[model samples]
Target: MTQPSDYREHLMAAALFIAGRRWPVFPLRPGGKRPALHGEASCPRTGPCADGHRKWEERATTDPDRVRRAWSAGAFNIGLATGPAGLLVIDLDVPKDNTDAPDGAANFRALCERHGQPVPTTRTVRTAGGGTHLYFTAPASCRLHNTAGKLAPLVDTRAWGGYVVAAGSVIGGLPYETVGPALVHPLPGWLQFLLIPPHPVVRARAAAALRNAPAYARAALCNEEENVRNAPVGCRNATLLRAARALGRLVASGDLSRSAVETALRRAGQTAGLRDYECRSTITSALNWSIAHNSGRGAA
Candidate 1:
């Protein structure tokens, strides 16, 4: 007959595995996401807490002995403190309460396509709740904070002040498991741009150029902007690509300035709820490709 699950042993091994990676690990309440660390009010102010109450972030440790001792206390789930671990984790969550909200992974994929980029391949965990967590190394000297709905709908991030449930955690009879490479990749520059504040120098200059452009180029830009703004959810990226390609030909033919065309498409993409990085990447790429392949130079 098959042996029953050994809760403590299993959890201890899990905690050890993560700790071995040098990531500081803490505990979550078994079967839930809440931190299992002692609260300030309940602090006995003894042992490690002799001076004062130590929150989870302070108590998180990469030591195997501490992990084993902590796991011996109960069937605790692993919580990787991202900041201490030097990680930035992207949480692609499922729709809440069975609502009809868009799926996080799909939205993220669309966001990638809109920017002419492929999804970054990195360390990944499939959560028990049927979502995914992608892990990336945080940039040195940058203290990032958690962001909600910043990248896309259902796409959240955890860094300095947050933690992620690690593989080997369980909830509702499902285990969080590794589904990708063992190595965590450095965060991509494009993604970093999306997370940070944008500089307005290019956009300001692009607008000025558009004001002085010939009427035909201006009219063409107006038509393309409308197309992007009115594009439905599934068609937005394709529409933006097409418009960029068409305008790129104009730039090649000396009918419009590159920056002017780019500025118009960028605003139109953002109006359709695309992220800033996505708009810039897509427009720039399409323009480059179209300009290079322009056969009907000055035909218009």
Candidate 2:
């Protein structure tokens, strides 16, 4: 049996290995997802340490020295930050009742079939809970969202603003084991589209508006729309905000309904692969700014 000290050393080495790949990592409590730290009683602040280790998302770091120090303090599991690390992990959870139906994997396969592409083999981690974690590099313009059972029963995603317990981490004496190739693959474009579909209302209105526009105006609109669709990930939010502002102007000119313009810009933003929360916030903020400066014509 591996001694407790040996296990601690293994975790430290593993954490450094992941960090070497540019993935930000943090320490988790031994055998758990929680940050490896003393309880709130150890916190000196009267309220709480909002930026402490317990805040794994904020505390996750790629600094090798910090990782070394954290692991040296005690036995700790590894935690991988999803967003900042530019990763999207598909988590296939095993059913607790020991049923043989692998619904999650089945649905994932079905989704791949619909896209007419084979599932890419990537780094896969077998969870101590009998689940599997498939790692992929996030798409250029896309921000995948964390969802539970949305793709299929027992399937989950850890994306931006989330974290995953790293492979080689132990919980309750069971270590997460690597089950496949160690390389993370690029997410396929078709799958990216499905995962980040446009909002229905916005899609409908945008289509209708485009269909009714004059030919010359339609050409300009098409060009503008294409710019949003082709934006890169880092600029997607800003592109969407600009689109929203332009739409706000159209609304002020009585060329489009205020709600429709907002929805359409939001839909285009989402389809171009922006994070939903950030996309919506950008749309709202941009529209408000436009209205405030444009004589309150598109106020809503």
Candidate 3:
């Protein structure tokens, strides 16, 4: 039986999202371009930043007051843009999604689960060439960049294939009409009032929040490949080895222990810090390749 589109049902669905712990922002206008956030300022045309990235950064900085205002306007459907590589777009009208008719809905859900992101509901767009849009909520304290950065690594979607719809957009995907306003997911209320200045307490809080991020996020951050590639060689070798070993063991036995894997990563980091250095991304690709190809090694 066809069910009626109840506004209340959506409101209720949004309410259930609160259980996911994401902070609410502005009303999300589903299936349309979202407006720029209130306090955002424009980035300078020049000076050490990518044009696109600079623009958004400027907006975020310039419109401090407006941004604060928007933060205060509390509601669901609002979302912050984030990515380890930077902000991205989700162009749903791409030829691939149309031609392949891929099981994006399932893939999206699985990716979310694998990354430890709370499961979000998946729906098919009712447009001419149907596409899919997945939705879920995370802790309000979770920064958009961390969330996106973490999710980006886990997803297998093609770049132009599945872009992230930016804020101020009504069309989530061509076929998938985003029901905004009450359905919006915003930043957490507590986060809005945070000072975010150079303070011990704030720093401590930030560290704690980062530590509490979903397992997938922590794993990605500590992944041997990413850490080694980004860090100095002598420092990252052991971690790289540990990461490779973990993936090898997981693929070979299909039995990966989360605690064990983290312990190895901690060892690698400690080994490096003793020499005084941290932060690595150089070996990320190699480690990823090793982990992915391990299972295929004798399959042919």
**Cα lDDT tens digits for candidate 2, 157-199:** 8888788999778877787888867998987766566467456
Evaluated at residue 266, the lDDT of candidate 2 is 56
Off by over 4 Å in 3: 1-54, 60-103, 111-118, 121-138, 146-176, 179-182, 185-300
Residue 183 of model 3 has an lDDT of 42
lDDT of 1 by residue, 221-247 (tens): 999999999899989989999999989
Q: What C-alpha lDDT do the candidate models reach, one value each?
A: 0.86, 0.75, 0.36
Residue-level lDDT for 109 in candidate 3: 53
True-structure lDDT of candidate 3:
0.36
Q: Can you give the lDDT of residue 173 in candidate 2?
A: 79
Q: Give the TM-score of each candidate.
A: 0.68, 0.62, 0.28
TM-score of 2: 0.62
Regions of candidate 1 where Cα sits further than 4 Å from its true position = 1-4, 197-300
lDDT of 3 by residue, 100-211 (tens): 5434444445544544455432322222234433332323443332222222222322121122332222233322244433342432232222211123664455456546
Worst 10 residues of 3 by lDDT: 274-283
Model 3, residue 101: C-alpha shift (Å) = 8.2
